[model samples]
Target: MHLAMIGVGYVGLVSGACFAEAGQTVICMDVDPQKIEGLRRGEIPIYEPGLEDFVRRNVAAGRLSFTTDLNDAVDRSQVIFICVGTPSREDGSADLHYVDEVARGIGRTMDAYKVIVNKSTVPVGTARRVRRLVSKELARRGLDLEFDVVSNPEFLREGSALHDFMQPDRTVVGVESAKARQLMAELYRYWTEKKFPLYFMDVASAEMTKYAANAFLATKITFMNEIANLCALSGANIDQVRVGIGSDSRIGDRFLFPGLGYGGSCFPKDVKALIYMGKTMGYNFNILEATNLVNQAQRHRFIFTIGSFFDHQLDGKTLALWGLAFKPNTDDIREAPALTVMERLLDLGADLRVYDPVAMLEVQKHYENYPYPERIVYAPTPEAALEGADALVINTEWDVFRQFDVSRLKNLLKAPVVFDGRNIYDPAQMKQAGIHYFYIGKPIY
Candidate 1:
């Protein structure tokens, strides 16, 4: 398969690399020349586990390449994947201008039959919109080109993107024509041969599936957070509740762990986009609305608990903060709870020493224009962040943070007090270690 992944962002870069590794000839195109040059020089823009090695190996094998010229990519590929970002607009709908631009470019440059796949997570009916845009552009050029638009939404997690791509639970492809369907099947024959499910449906359903999956997961996390908050108020343990309920065959444990709430590039944006879509169709997603409100409140609730512990006197406090990325194993900080916590703490006149394995540089860039950038010191290591700090705060549940020695943590902190947002540590263990511990949805130990 000759694949052209337009937009070498997180989705495009990962997908292109994976396809190349699967023996497909892939050309990843980006509008940014600097990014294209960097990729050509073996510089990966985003951090995903095993992505750099995967890209490098494929590039070395001459199966993968990068370019800034969309025309070149369009001309050389049989399957063109629109893997651009569908960022959330002010109205909470997806901004599809990038997708539109790519569609127009493809129509202008494509002289033969091509399978144009929507690999980006977009709203329902975007495939038809892309088809219309392409037809309009081709008509203006006085050129009649035969092409098919297919919706093949990607269901990838940030930290485990490569694994998700290679070992997908099920691949959903929405196609309108028989030709497009056969081409998609042939493209994913590697996974299909391994007995991984490849589902074919209408384009709208495929688009809806992506949004529905993310929204439901977001709602599940929000529900758990809600239950955790109630457990705390009612003198019950959320951990016990989680296990008891998770063991039920109907409610298998996944996204059951409660924390500062769900925050990532996909969940927050997808949920909002779904809600907006509902409004547009004269329908109301009441549960999703509550989920959004509760998720945001969960972060503030954690921050408020911290403030109350200090009797609202957070001034002059030096806090040790762990985790800057939204989740573990990825350097993406979009909508991360750590950002909310840090901003609120800074507003309250508290200085923070923060550390994440690979996200410190991102955090530094994030705070470049902030009023109190100096107050948020980027620590070299987790232990270094804890040294001489008033207390430790865990935001993201990275594996390294989970393996910290209790005695060492106690000795390094000015006070042996810890506020665990991710509930990484057991309450009994913290109690036995003689450390004052606060965590979500549980009695303070």
Candidate 2:
């Protein structure tokens, strides 16, 4: 199959690489010539695990290419995948301008029958809207071309996107016509050998499925966070509560760990979009509203815990921050809880020395234009962050931080104080090391 991926973002790049690896000829199109040129020169724009290897391998095999010319890409492909971004608008609605532009471009350029697949996470009626835009463009050209728009949302996790794409548990495809369904099935026939299930549903349901799944996962994380907070007040341990509750067949152990609230690209945006969707329809999604509230409050509660430890006297404190990425194994810092903590600490006039495996450059770039960029110091190593600092705060649960020498940690810091946001360390070990440890959902010692 010949495929044209409209936008070269995370979803488009990963999907295009995986599809090319599956023996499909793919051209990943983007508006930025610089990004396309960078891809051509083996320079990947994003830091995703295993993505650079995939792009380079497929490009070397002549199965995948990158381009800024949308018309050329559209004219040569039988399947056009709308993999553009739908960032949240101010009102929490999905900003579909990019998707609409791609649809209009496809309608204007596609000379033959093509299968248009919506692989981006979008609102329920976006496929219908894209169909109308494409039809309108075709009418303007006075050309009657047949194209089928299929809603096929992706469910790839960020850190493990390549594996998820290559080994998806299930694929949900929404189609209106039998022809579209058959074409989609043929496109996904490669997965049938792996015995991965394919679900066929209406377009609206498929769109709703993506939002519902993320919202539910976000809700689960929020619920666990609430329970963790309550456990802290009642002198209970969340680790035990999590194990006891997750052992139930009904409640699995995924996304149940108590940590800083859910962030990154999908969860925060999808939850807000769903809430906004409900408001638009004259319905109130009360649970989701609370979920959003709880997630936001989790960050503040963590900040307050840190502040209370110092008796609200944070001025001139040199703190060692362990992580900056929203989660481990990726360099994405969007809506990262670490940033919230860093900002609040800076506001309280504390000097920060931060370290992350791969996200330091990103955070430094972000602070370049800040008012007090000099207040934020970059550390060469995690141990370097602890040097000459008053205390340590573990913001992200990176593997290196998880298995660090606790005894050395107690020796390195000016004060043997630790604030663990991700609850990565064992409390008993901290106690044995004679280190002051504070973590989420348990007694502080």
Candidate 3:
């Protein structure tokens, strides 16, 4: 199959590479010339784990390519995957201009029958909207070309996107016609042959599935955080509660970990988008609304706990912050709880020495326009971040942070105080090491 992936961002790039690795000829198209040129030279734009190697390997094998010209990609490919970003607007609705532009370009450039797949996370009616835009463009060009707009949303996690793409639990495809269904089945035959489930549904259902899945996961995380907070007040251990409930077969545990709430590219944006979507339909997603409020409050609550420790006086405190990328194994800081903590702490007049494996550069860029960028120092290592700091604040729960030498941490910090937002450390262990440890869902030790 010849595939053209429009908009070579995270989803587009990962999907295109994975499809190419599956033996399809994939040409990834993007508007940015520099990004396309970088891909040509084996330089990947995003910091997804194993993505660069996957892209480079596929390019070396001649199964993958990059192009800045959309027309060429559309003309040469039999399958056009609209994988552009549907960024959330201030109104919480998905901004679909990029998807619209790609659909119009495809309508203008496609010369024969093509299977146009919507792989981007969009609203329920977006697939139909794309179909109408394509039809309108074809009418303007006075060409009666047949094309099928299929909704095939991606469910790839950021850190383990390659694995998720290749080994999805199930694939949901929304097709309008039997022909479109057959084409999509053929495209995913590799996975289907291996018994990976491929579910076919209506376009609207498929679109709603993505939003529903993300919103539910966000709600689950928020619910867990709420439970953790209540546990803290009632002297209950969230870990024991989590294990107790997680062992239930009916409520299989995932996303039940108590943390600084859910923050990443998908959950927060999708939850907000779902809320806005409900409002547009004259329906209220009360649980989701509360979920959003709770998620945001979770971050503030952690910040307040930190402030209360200092008697609300945080002026001139040097703190060591570990972890910056929303989660570990990726450099994506969008909507990260760490950023919220850093900004709030800085507002409280504290100096921070932060360190992350790969997200330091991204955080530095994020703080470029801040009023006082010099207040936050990017440390070279975790130990360096702890040097002369009054307390240690754990944000991202990277594996390196878990393997830290507790004695060394106690020795390095000016004060043996630790605020663990991710609950990565054990309270008993901290107490044994003679370190003051404060974590989520437990009494401070």
Candidate 4:
């Protein structure tokens, strides 16, 4: 199968490369000339685990390629995946300018029968709009070329994108025509063979399903964070409560880990977009509203923990930060809680020493405006971050940070105080090491 992927962003790149690795010839198209040139040379722009190896291997095998010509991609491939970004506007609506532009571009360039798949998460009814655009453009060219629009949203998590792509829990296909379904089934033959059910539904439900899944997960995290806060005040432990409640098969634990909060490209934007869409229909989403409130409060609460630890005299406190990215094993900083912690601590007059496995350079790009790089240090290692620090605050749960030597941490820091935002270690262990530890849903010890 010859496949064309428009927009070589995170999803497009990973999906296109992985498809090529699965024996399909893939041509990735992008508007940016520099990005296309880099891809031609096998230079990946994003930092994802195992992605570079996947891209390099497929490119070496001649199954994958890159280009900037949209018409050529349209002419060569029978299936096209639209995997562009849909960032949120200030009013919390998903800004579909990029997706719209690509749809229009596809309408103009498409030559023959092709399955135009929506691989990016978009608001409902986008597939109809895409179908209209392509139809209008084909009419304009006076070529009655047939094309079918399908919704095939991705469920790839950032850290484990390759794994998720290879072993998806399920594959969704939204199509109005049996022809589109057959083409999609043929494309996903690899997954279908392994019994990953391909759900065929109308376009609207498929679009709504992606937003619903992400928003629900975000709500779960927000609810747990709120419960964790109440637990801290009521002399209860969230970890224990989480385990006890999660024992139920219905409430099985997955995203229930209480922490600074849920932050990434998907959850925050999708929640707001859903609420915004509801408002456009004159409905207020009360549950989503509360979820947003609780998530915001969780960040401030974590900051308060750090402030209370220092008795609000965080002024001139040299704090060591263990993680920079929102989560571990990826360099993505979009909506990261660590950035919120950094800003609040800086405003309160604390200096920061930060370290992460992969997000240091990404953080530096945004924090280049810091007037005190002298005060805000970027450590090469976790121990280097603790050099002469007042205390240690854990943000992302990198494997090394989770298993750091307690004695070394005590010897390196000026104080043995730790604000464990992720609750990675047991309170008993921190207590046994003679370290002052403050964690979510648990009292300071």
Could you give the C-alpha RMSD of every candidate to the true structure, in order shown? 1.0, 1.1, 1.1, 1.4
Where is model 3 poorest over a 10-residue stretch in terms of lDDT? 436-445
Model 2: what TM-score?
0.98
Candidate 3 per-residue C-alpha lDDT over 268-376 given as tens digits, one digit per residue, 9 for 90 to 100: 8899899999999999999999999999999999999899999878898999999999999899999999999999999898999999999999999988998887788
lDDT of 4 by residue, 1-445 (tens): 9999999988999999889978899999999999999988878888888999999999999889999998888889999999999888999998888888888888888777899999998988789888888888878888788788999998888989989998888888889899988888898898889887888899889998999899999999888888888888888888889999889899988888999998888889999999998898899999998898889889898899789878988887899998888888889999999999998898899988999999999999989988877768999999899988999999999999888878667889999999988999888988888898888888533
How many steric overlaps does candidate 1 have?
0
In order, the Cα lDDT scores of the candidates are: 0.93, 0.92, 0.92, 0.89
TM-score of each prediction: 0.99, 0.98, 0.98, 0.97
- CA shift at 211, candidate 2, in angstroms? 0.3
Write model 1 residue lDDT over 40-159, tens digit each, in one string: 999999889999999999999999999999999998999999999888999889989999999989988888999999999999989999999999989998988889999999998999
Using lDDT as the measure, the top candidate is: 1
Off by over 4 Å in 1: none
Q: How many residue pairs clash in each candidate at the backbone level?
A: 0, 0, 0, 0
C-alpha positional error of residue 243 in candidate 4 after TM-score superposition, expressed in Å: 1.1
